[model samples]
Target: MAATNNQDLESKIATEVGHADVYDEKAAISDFKADAIEAENAEHNMTVLQAVRAYPMASFWAFVMSCTIIMESYDVFLMGNFVALPAFRNKFGVPYPGHKDYIIETKWQQALQVSGQLGALIGVFLAGPLTSRIGYRWATLTGLMLLNIFIFSMYYAESLPVMFVSQLLEGVPWGIFIANAPAYCSEIVPIQLRAPCTQMLQMFWAIGSIIVNGVAYNYNSLDSDIAYKVPIALQWMFPTPLMVLIFLAPESPWWLTRKGRFEDAAKAVERLGRKSAVNSTETVSMMRRVIDMEKSVKKPNHLELFKGTDLRRTLIVCGVYAAQNLTGNLIANQAVYFFQQAGVDNELAFALGLITSALQMVFVMLSWILTTYYGRRDIYLWGSFANFVLLIALGIAGSTGTNNAASLAQASLGLIVSVLFTLGPAPASWVIIGETSAIRLRPLTTGMGRATYYIVEIPCIFLASYMLNPTGGNLGGKCGYVWGGTAFICLAVAWWGLPEMKDRSYREIDIMFKRKIPAREWKKTEIDVNDDE
Candidate 1:
């Protein structure tokens, strides 16, 4: 479902100055197809409240699939938190250099972190092809089944090597979960609901993180293996119930349409929205029109992502994800430790970390308000600019001697950086990644896009370690300067690169990209292809 850069499409642009330009019909849509497109467009153009009222099930189903992301968040936090657990360290560690306390080796921490990411990378690359082959419903089921089994290994593992293997295996299903949740939401919901639904993924992620932080804190003092095991056991809360939900939830209509399962697609549409508000058959026809519009020589291959307008789309999508780490969000991840390094007491630092995690959830919900009123491009741009400013301020705060005044300033700025991050780049990234990705190449494009997190993450983790270590850069909050510098570069790239995808439907977006519309001019440039009956 790919084509080379559509020079023909560019030539077809009627030399118009603004969006009101009309194109002569090259082909006409029949009343049946026209009704379908128009009906869907009517829904697409609905207000957020109108859309939600119209399609309540859309939100429910999106939430059903997104629950796994919460689990992914909790699981990642649990692994990272293990190094601090008294029981976990005693069970998995050796004598420290100068104390009776046990310590998990630095090498093991790094190894486990890298290996989990590697497994996730493998699963991400596999998700596109696997979902393409099996369809979203079955692929999700398959992932759930694997997750249930994999948890066993994690729960029972007695050694670091065995636990490392468990984490490696566990990441695969989580990766698939990551790759699928947003795409499914994008497809099922109308354009009005799409951004909010996908952005909600981050809210769920923060919820999981907060839960695990609480769980780890409560359990860490335990002198038994249950400290870690209970947290790992909590993961079971997701897969089994979700398996039931997947069985009950309708399949993605987009995937159904692509498979040429038209009748089933119509039924799935019926299942996802109110029957009175939705015309299932007409909606199915809309999917057909879009699929036909995007179809090209043979079925879509992953290589198509690199050819034509898709290459630009892929780069923008990847940049949205990688920008998360580049913009000093990592500093947010280490908030408690950074606070301690800034001279805050451990109790206060941990309390601040809890507040930071909770605020992250609040900020994600705040993104819904921002996107509802503003464009995705603006949120990203302003978000990046804000982060750049904050990082520079943080660096300056850090430059002063590590006194209470400077430390408090650094800690305060860092917390703002974290919560504000969720409001801007973190959630906006999902919206852009969900909205801007080529729909036909969505699974593959999204998979590759999500993979960039791990790709950017590995090096960032290594560098953050060195930069923060007492014997290394010892840069403290000055680390913000390095990330802020990168944020500046990313902000520039995003400014010159990101397009406004506020509320455009897939068909409208496809047409604009086909005609090679200028990035900055997307809001001003509009075209209507008359599908005359």
Candidate 2:
């Protein structure tokens, strides 16, 4: 009698959630949403490492997928060093005596870098429809092909205007690639591996930055234009092989389900792993269940992103990524420039830049190991707290004047902040965004989240430029106060707003949101995936 009563209660909840019968599409969609607990239980049953060992091909392909963002990293680090190089700056910049050779006029420096960001913003917006319509493989191929072409143009350019145009065009591919890569990784992999796999993209990005820094450190002093052009041309090496690999990659099963090609979706899953513990039948049914449930709720649209509980998620994701920008990241991004602006020479600045990149790469690797063992929210909060203290110290050091002691203090502070950021906010931001959105609108929401993030960063970018430039505000290390305040706000947001989602599947996340559980409570809440009611 008790079991019968429990079944009745569960049936009522299913009906309220829009449960339908197995053969009927309406019944399937409704029933799946109503009973998402079972699916969630199945999805997250295995540990991430176990999942990887069970399906090696999935892990291999995810590694390949992570490589897609190397260009963005390559562009940022290479450009940072470019502005510091005398040979390249001499071609388009006004000569300055106190500085190394020349400084690109403050306005042009802002425009050249902002142009890439603006183009990236546009590319992210376009990526949603492009990937949705053409599929992930083709969309990625399109971006990679176009990115290589733009790099060639930038390399051959003779004037500032031509170079600026190339940079803007160059950002389009990067934007598209960035928006899609995380979504692709999330969709293709199992739930346990989702956060770590998405984060591997950041690791690849760090590797790219390390490579560019090494190249610039060695080649920046060359006598001819070849010095700059060689680094730009080096970007050409990544796309061709990526293009070939992506051609052989399987289409996302979720994408196939979105198109109602259930058979093809099953085949794609089979291709991902033929004899894994998660056989094709079980995985395909789960996909259909969740996919149909989402369709019953609504189409995957950006407007729905702001509706009800989803609004909480959108804000959290947007805040985390935006905080990533505001939390003194630009300082690290423009390290070579900021280091030179202080008392450091160009050679040491380049060397320090290389060290910063290498440390971040190491920390990123550490983040991978740590993320496997820790929760995202804790790492993010702890990291924010550390930055708050470090940035305050940085500001205090800068206020002491530019004596040798103060300069050394400021440089030491910058290096420390670099390590803390990679461990905390840098890797955490991307992982949180990857897990925050609903699976159906994952691409649209991720794109929207990143696009808004870059928008907030535009003003921050301008501020970093003004303070770092000699002829401008020239605040140098003192600019730490401004970003320090923002980091404090980010810390508070992490404490109050960020939820703990270490190993929760999308279904569990949905259930939690539906119950309106407080962010802080998520770590301790025991979700009963097999509950009858």
Candidate 3:
């Protein structure tokens, strides 16, 4: 009678979670979920080395998928760098009075920048449902394939309109990459490795920037169109290699478990980890246990992102990602262009951009070191505060003069901002975006959060184009004033709402949010990882 009653309770839970298929097997399953939870607790308690020994392949694949950002970043930075090259300007721009080089008009520049972001926004929303239906590996593969087709538009376009549409359509696949890459990486790795794995997005962001800027700097003097076309064609190399590799990658065990493919989930866990070190069957049960517990907490739908405790989670993610756009990411990305407008010569500006990208690679690793010791909240808050201060200084210097003295000061300041941003808030934001969302709804939540990034970025891009363009507002270095104000606002919000989630398990995170604890209390509150409840 006791056994029957226990089965009845589980049946009720399955029914409540709307998993009728699971409810049908409740009698046969017994109480293995408790054992699953216990297994998860033990694994969570594993040392970093042990976890790595167990799941090296998982780590590799996480990094491999996260590198999808490299393609998108390369494309974005390519567009920004190409504008400084005479070949690009001659191909797509009109001559301006008193200027030695042809220039893209402010309206056309804004149109090109805005079109990609708009297309990205469209793709970001679509990625959620598409990933839901097809799963991560294939969804990612589809986006990779789409990128191949879109490159034709960019490479062959003889007119601005064609380039505009190319950028717009290319954004769709990039948007898919932005939404899924980090979120997917967060899922495959053990919690201990989550921060580093997901933060690879930033590490690769620097790499992509470095490669594209390097290409532009070396080829800037070329009198032929190949200077720009070669960079555009390089984009084609990314999709094919990624597609083949993604085809061989393991599916997210969590996604497999969600689809009632418990056996397949077990196989994935086995495949993801070392055969000797991992118990695949037990691992899948642990995933099911967490997934089911989350399912009981809330429905896994887009609407749930705005409801209950999830609303807070949603807001935190959106704020974290949005914070980047406001904090001079716009300036760093267009450093070459911004440097020119600040009075530096074209070649030197592009040269400085290459150096900036290389430094960010070093600083991004420093962020990892800091994240390990200090925690996400401190990194984000302090990093953002530093940017707030530096951008203000930059604005002040920009107001000092328009000569070489002022230009060099602003350029030096911008480099510091870029390096520091990478080491702190930039990487911190990616980690937070992965950890802060409700686990069951993370893919959609991550998509929505990244969507917020582009949404905020659109206007910043518009304003940035105006600030740098001689044809528009032409604020040049003084645009720092505008960004500094926004950075401070973001910094204030982080202090009031961001939580330190260092070394947290998903189950612990779910309970803390469900209890509605204050964000600052996340550090003080103790969560028992072993507690099955």
Candidate 4:
């Protein structure tokens, strides 16, 4: 039955793509026969720089797929900014005793914010089954179409309940998108392009955030409610183009292979690699060998995520994501609230937020350049440490000093923190987790990690909101102390557990874990996957 399915797929793909020799060239094998494959075919893959010079279309499509994260970024920035808008507040909350502006009650605010995360948690668990069944391209398209409905709801919302439900529904697409997009992006590129391309998720996130902050800074102060609606309407711009482009994009090659569609997988590789049929055939063969080895060793199940070497990989992936939330980024999200608490005027606060997003954009670009030379572990280790020290400075400057200098210092530190966090943990966290999983378990492990991340993230979001709210905890900069301590712990974990996966292939990563190589030695130890195969 499987052989018949393979032949049917081969005929269809060859007819459509003109790659007719796919099946006749080599018989698919379940076992890893190292000697049968050439060293050049199995390893010695293109570097990030070389891949782009060779295949510009591959990079272009990668940038297109990363639009999923851009949508995720725009939504998060828009929601955080919405609470700071005068019109949104006036519509949702009671007016203050002496002031004209209104604010949501602390508890209701927290509930509204965390509801999206809860929805995301549900989406993360669902992504594995849906993406596996429908394939990556369709799953992403489905999520984007659903997200458009929810975005319009927020634009038209007149009451708190409607907006709350809208935010919750919005998060469903976000969870599914976040769960699957990174894996898809990583799979579509070569090993050299893998980390840099996946890191585009974070870069585009900062781009979306900058766009929202730029728009909100200009429109947030209008007397009418259209100020907020215009920004909410901007959400439409992202999905429309993404939907059109995604329709034209190919399904993940790795995903096609998983479903016993080898001919289709080869065509995808040919498209992505811009190579001849022979090279694409060899690439598909190599991936099939790795995937076969993985499934034969253990059943691909959710329970397996918590078993053996995978347990460690899963834990590290989850920890990296959780560390992203805990490292004072929660305060960055509450930029307007923090500025209001520090006695900065509303306009200046919005300007600072704009500048913060811009600086994050700069640092994310810097991260791309740095990753070319550095490993993921040391970058995370140093970035977290610097972030902790900055947090302490921000906390002291914010809590004790009441003058202009102190306020300026606090804001300065906040901007610097944003830059360092972007350079260190922000992009690296997503890249590390996306690269760490086996192809068969990529969706399940990445989803579980993100779900765990949101589990830790929900409380941090609420706490950051409460601490900065004038009617709530009002911790001001003092909230930094709590998160700073958390950053220190994350730093230690990175130093101890995270491995160097720079330029490493999925097959190499699998072999390293199987051999029980210590995390610190991953860089020094050479595992020739081609020779071992």
Candidate 5:
């Protein structure tokens, strides 16, 4: 009996030892996988961050792009402000109430607005094919030349019609640059930093407005023809340096790829990536992957933007850009003129314009910071909502004939709204433009989107002029109501339809929206290489 009991105890101890060994092996395997995953995640995060940080060349390219865009912003604001410039009005022979030669009535103002828009429409429509054929770099250079020629021509114009023709020619370059610059910035930067870099374009636009107003104010005070002539002549100086500088810069890698120059494209990509002087296998592999991916994708045509697979993307982009233009932000560009109509002095009004533009620049930078952490949808919703409220307040203040103090208060509130708007949709919209479409489709779609934007903008420009006419009697406030309504529509679209793009790769974004990949399973999915290559 004692021997049998000892045998049972020995057997039980052996069984327990066997189970312990099995558990240890399993635990070791699990720990190894966790470590591997953590390492991979860290490496991936580092790679993305490094790519973003090493984008100064791309940023420089973007800055050059912005210089041309700054001209556009300068032209828009300067034209509006020039309406009130004593030299401009006097040379054009705009009549006062008792004067005989006063042909500068509301109708002429409306006509000038229409003429600019008509030229813009034609120019925007022409930009798509021109950009595709000549590349954005050349297109930008050509547009800059045209812009300078026309802007300088305005200085010699003796009549309103000649000046009108100058503005009309100016619109062509204006339309082309607007469509091209955002596309250039989007293509140059890595996916994660797209929004911030694009927002930098907006930053310069605000700078341009400020500079225009500042120069105009100083020029307005001078008694000589040099006042108007110098400011207008200075427009020629704006884009020539940038065009010459960018001419020295390399063309976009993506554009090279599109033209089937793979080797050159790879070198361009390497330069942009700023890889070490000693090339590594990993850098070569990464660039080859980008090139191979470009080769595999079907290239998009301009007409295909309105057709199957890309139609939804096209519509969303168009709607967003249109809303951007129509939301009355451009009206704010003319804010000094608006205040002047409300009885503010020219110096005080220009001062207020400078303040508003400065605030816009500040908020655009702040918005760039927010975009790094938050989802695009959240920013768009909150920003548009704030803009909605502020527009209502401004409209109310306008309708009630508020005093200078009250107007200042309303303007302050409007500045806050502008800040929020910049923080939200303004920057995000550019990001969405890049993210939503296939790589091949991006340029054409961006052009189409911008075309729609400018098309919608033309009507809004004229409408704002008509509304703000003192004789229009409360229509200006009513236009603000329209802007508020547009903001509301944008909010609804954002909540129900907008996809979350934060932290997603361009490939991941394409898969999610274009391929209908389920949100829950997206993390588990991987892109598979096609064996055909």
Candidate 6:
């Protein structure tokens, strides 16, 4: 009787548990699917985060490479201060007129500037082929060589024509260096920190400008010929040390992968990652993915920039960069003259040049901090908005015909606006350029962007001469119009065209147009690869 009861109870319990097992299994399947999706998402997030974390190290070396290039920007702008001084023009037999009219306002000076741009035009075209053939490392070295040769030659260049030729040759390297540096920085830096790293280079360029300005200011006061010659000759100093250092620096692993040198590329990636001699499966996998992607896509030409999805992006890049050049900053390469027009003494003008350069560095640092913490869009928008307000204030101040305290206040406001100009769009423009384009298209896109920059700058520089000419009507008001017009355009572009790329991965940005995500929704939108599949 006991065994019969036990068997009956066991049978009942088994029947109940059998139904429970079916329910449990169904639940488990659902959980497993959800978990798989979560795991993939987590894995993707980790991959992107890792890339972000790895950016600083890679960008540090690239920053060092950039120092070499920034020296060129220094040389370009330093002329503004030096040309205003008696030392440079007098020694070189170039005439130095009063403040509103100086050697820089002359036909020869205009030619020199134009020649540099002409060389840049050619150099931009040459950079792709040269970099493609010799690799970025050697291409940079070639640029350094050209820069050094020109710098050393500038010391002995007796006539305007000779100086023009030297400046023209200098543009080749300048174009090559600027063109390739962005791609180099972009390739080596992780996507998350790409904006900051590239912007850091711009900051350094500003720092270079400061250093050159300060040095030129000091040399300007000196009576010796060596004052100008020494500073100009020092141009060779940065490149040699940079070349030696970069000789040990790892070449871009992406470039290596492009050339089909997988083993060498692997080694470079290892060095970039600061890993031991062991093989990196992750690096290899990324390399393979990149190579495969390159193989699958059709390469775009310059004309393609105006058609298809690329057209919108190209236009924005062009507009932003053009605005950057047109905003009177590069034109402010003639800052010394502007100061003199403001009735500042020559010594004070040089002093102010140094101060302005230093202040720009400070603002750029603030910009970097804001960029890292605040969103790119906010900084860009606020920058333009503030600039617009300041420009309007300047216009009002100029219109009042007041040279008293009110005039000084307006001038101060203008300087502040210029500082904001540096802090805001100047650095932001490059970051946007780096972030928006695909890696394969970076060179062409940056080339076009820079081409727009120079093209716009050439005309602006010429126009500035006409507007600020003492003989012209109401020079201050005319200059105000230029600034005011630029400020308005920047405001409009920031409002409508500029995309918010902050915290978004390059892959996400790559899908921006394809998915047609609005700029405001960029950060909040989750890119769904499965939908395309």
Judge candidate 1 against the unseen true structure and give its global Cα lDDT, from 0 to 1: 0.81
For each candidate, what TM-score against the reference?
Answer: 0.90, 0.91, 0.93, 0.91, 0.82, 0.83
lDDT of 6 by residue, 1-533 (tens): 99999999999999889989998998965554444344234324543346545443575777776676577677777555555666666655433445332344455545655667777867777776677677778888888777777776677887778877877787888888777777787677554556666777677777777878788787777767777777777677687888787777778877787667878877776666545322334454454443444353454467766776667777777777788765556435666656655555678777777777788878877776677657677787887777767767766766676466654554465567657777887778777876666555566777787788788877776666556545343365337666778768767866887788776544456667656666667767776632221
Backbone Cα, N, C clashes tallied per candidate: 2, 6, 0, 1, 1, 0
Overlapping backbone residue pairs in candidate 2 total 6
lDDT of each: 0.81, 0.81, 0.86, 0.80, 0.67, 0.67
Which model is ahead, 5 or 6, in terms of TM-score? 6
Better of 3 and 4 by TM-score: 3
Residue 305, candidate 1: Cα error in Å is: 0.9
Write one digit per residue (lDDT tens) for candidate 5, span 1-533.
99999999999999999999999998965554444334223323643357565655776777777677777777677777776666666666456664332334565565665566566666767777788788888888888788767776677877778778887888888778777777778776665567677777778788788888888878876656777777777777777898788787667766776676767766765666566521223332333343444353545577777776567778877877887876667666676666666556778877777777787788878888777667566776777777888777767766666567766655555555555666677877766666666556666777788778777877777677777765344254445676777777777776666666666644445545556554335445564422111
Lowest lDDT 10-residue stretch of candidate 5: 277-286
User: After superposition, which runs of candidate 5 have C-alpha atoms over 4 Å from their true positions?
Assistant: 1-44, 47-49, 96-104, 277-299, 402-405, 474-478, 517-533
**Model 2, poorest ten-residue lDDT window?**
30-39
Top-lDDT candidate index: 3
Inter-residue clash pairs, candidate 2:
18-30, 19-30, 19-31, 20-27, 20-31, 21-27
lDDT of candidate 3 over 1-533, digit per residue (tens): 99999999999987787776667578435556655766677676877778888889998998889889998789778878867778988878899999988998888888877778888898889888888778899889989999899999889988889888999899998888898887788888887778788888999999999999999998999989889889999888789998999999989988898888988888888888888987777777777777767775433678989988989999999999898899998988888998888888888898899999999999988887788667899988889988999999999988998877999998999888888899899998888888888667877988899899899999888888988899998888788899999999999999999988888777778888888889899998988755544
Question: Clashing residue pairs, candidate 1?
Answer: 1-300, 19-526
Residue 106 in model 6: shift from native, Å?
A: 3.8
Model with the higher lDDT, candidate 2 or 4: 2
**lDDT of residue 90 for candidate 2:** 84
Q: Kindly list the per-residue Cα lDDT of model 2 for residues 431-505, writing each as its tens digit.
A: 888888876777788788889877987788788899888878988788889889999988987899889888876
lDDT of 4 by residue, 1-533 (tens): 99999999999977866543443334233223433254234344555566776556667788898888877778777778878878778878887676668888787778777877888898898887788788888888888899888887878888888888888888888898889878888888776676677788888888988998899899877968888888878888888788899889988888899888999998887777656323676677777767876875544678988888888888888888888888998776667667767777899989988988888888888887777568687788888899999999888888776788877777777778876788988888878988998788888888888898789989988888888887778777777788889888888878888999987777788888888899999999887645443
Backbone clash pairs for candidate 4 read 34-533
